[model samples]
Target: MSLWVDKYRPRSLDQLSFHPSITQNLKALASTGDFPHLLVYGPTGSGKKTRIYATLHELFGPSVEKLKIDVKTFTTSSNRKLEFNVLSSPYHLEITPSDMGNNDRVVIQDLLKDVASTEQVDFTNGAGNGSGGHGGPTRHRFKVVIINEADSLSRDAQAALRRTMEKYSSNIRLIMISNTTSNIIPPIKSRTLLVRIPAPSSAEVASVLAHISKKESVKFTDSNTEPFFEAVANNCECNLRKSLLCFETIAMQTAQINVSNDSTSIIKLDWEVIIENLAKSIAGNRTVANLAKARVVFYELLSHCIPPRVILKKLLFCLISEVKPSMATELVSIAATFDERLSLGQKSIFHLEGFTAKVMVALEK
Candidate 1:
């Protein structure tokens, strides 16, 4: 409860961990209900969900205690349809994936249909008499549907969801969170009150870390300080979630490497060091980077147990940025598709690199 990050999470709209203007827009939504169908567009692990949660918690606390908020939190790939009716308490409900599924278009469709139907959940009490909610007998008529990774939704799914959203506007408010809003349908965009949750500024991030250090009762040394910040900023390209994860990972490494709670000696790990290890293990960077150390490095990377898609993403990024400009765009577009295929579990992890020849060419530059 006292973790610095959580403790310091902007409790009020004014206190959000970002620009005052940004939080003000969010605060207005929380207090006034003008958030339309919100598209919280930004990278993952950013504060998109936090702000939403804060909004919900603040907006409906006493009422939420009285009226259940049935939340269905699933990715684009689940076999079951979520329901909200028979709950004992009229509180918030969340549906999260038990297992991750592939990024195939079909998976996207299933996600759309299930989520589009959120407006129709029967909040009726299980009693055949029709009065189970509110500790009396009737359920209220307010609902919010949140979709994570809206950018990953397929075009067709997006179209379907748009229609459903339009049809159900009176009963539902849709919020779609994503790394980028460009992938969302324009029709959906037109209806929703778009809110920008910008990445945390470096100063904000440091403040977060420094605050966390005190909360965790850890000591910080000067030498590894910059690296700690670097790791957080790098993981998601400044996504707070990933940064926190990287931060925690560094802390764990420190604890393990030193066998002491001495946070002062914690050595921050570089993103490249992580990339290098993973590449070595999977034999990914064989043709470039380090021929002499390929096998061992690949082995080391594999030993670290980096996920295939992460490896693929890294490989893709390396190619796009490090390679020649001639076909970088084409390579990136194809890689995005490949990443989808990998997520849909439609393709093997090893074959993802097949989409990388263009990238490989770029790396050669």
Candidate 2:
């Protein structure tokens, strides 16, 4: 069975919820034959990608949904071959150049040029010239290229992107998706229209959870279901994707445990539980030995595929709640320092360990 998030995902702009005005604006943009390059920025699980796909569907119909994954190899100026996987359809392609790390500039310039060089056929005439062709009135003039995690792209890659955007405007429309726009260069930002999607509110997330629950026929006692979902939403920190997964997990566990008998049993995600434990450990005793133990926990979290930045943020939140009011500001400052270092430096483990050690020292004072 498919996950509820994918199964219930809105197929078109009209089906989207939680931001009616944004959906309407996207529909309007899609209806037109010509639109500028778009920069969609938002927090995680804020529906930026959902809206992008919906707009593509509106532009090219259901054919956009027939996607296939391909591993493409590109050679840099130094003749280094870099291979990465991309998702593509007949009308558009999706790539995450950040996956290429420092060599992202090579992928950006080469991939964009390769895709943009092919000019599309004109179907404005509604009929081919004395031949059977795939032309019938409605057709787009250009293809779309979606680049995810654009904020993580290096400076050289962003510069390469700016040139590509200008050089290929006639044959391709670029859509850049990132968590923030501050990292995007001014030239690229100036050329593209920005669309900001905020995280959904708790009520909106709960409503989506309710819809999924009703559709899946998950039995929840009427008295406890609403508050349980609310707790899930709040715990997920307004991330719709995380909230949905949490709900599904709880639903499955509720079924296994006999929902009627264990109405108050709250199911916590394994990662959250681990982070909470680490928080308690850090708050309990500020010692050199405890700092070493925290290092082991940091590696444990890393083993589970949690990003270092996320781990740091969650630990900060937990510490804030457990410590005295005076320590909250100092902890936040420390987190911000390490967060910047984490972004600029290549060694994530060092920064993560450093942050934990610093937190312990701050607590002692």
Please tell me which predicted candidate would have the highest lDDT against the true structure.
2
lDDT of 1 by residue, 1-365 (tens): 44334555654444565667776666565554324678887655568877776666555443333434344333433554433221113333332221223232343345444544555334443222111112122222335666666766666666767776777665656677777776677888888888877778665776676567657665454434555565456544666665665566567555422323344323345645665454433334536444434434434555676555566677666555544577667767877876766544433434444544434444445
Q: Backbone clashes in each candidate structure, one number apiece? A: 22, 0
lDDT of 2 by residue, 22-44 (tens): 88888778766557899999999
TM-score of predicted structure 1: 0.63
**lDDT value, residue 273 of candidate 2:** 84
Count residue pairs with overlapping backbones in model 2: 0
Model 1 poorest 10 in a row by lDDT:
129-138
Q: List ranges where model 1 is wrong by over 4 Å.
A: 1-14, 62-140, 221-237, 249-310, 320-345, 348-351, 358-365
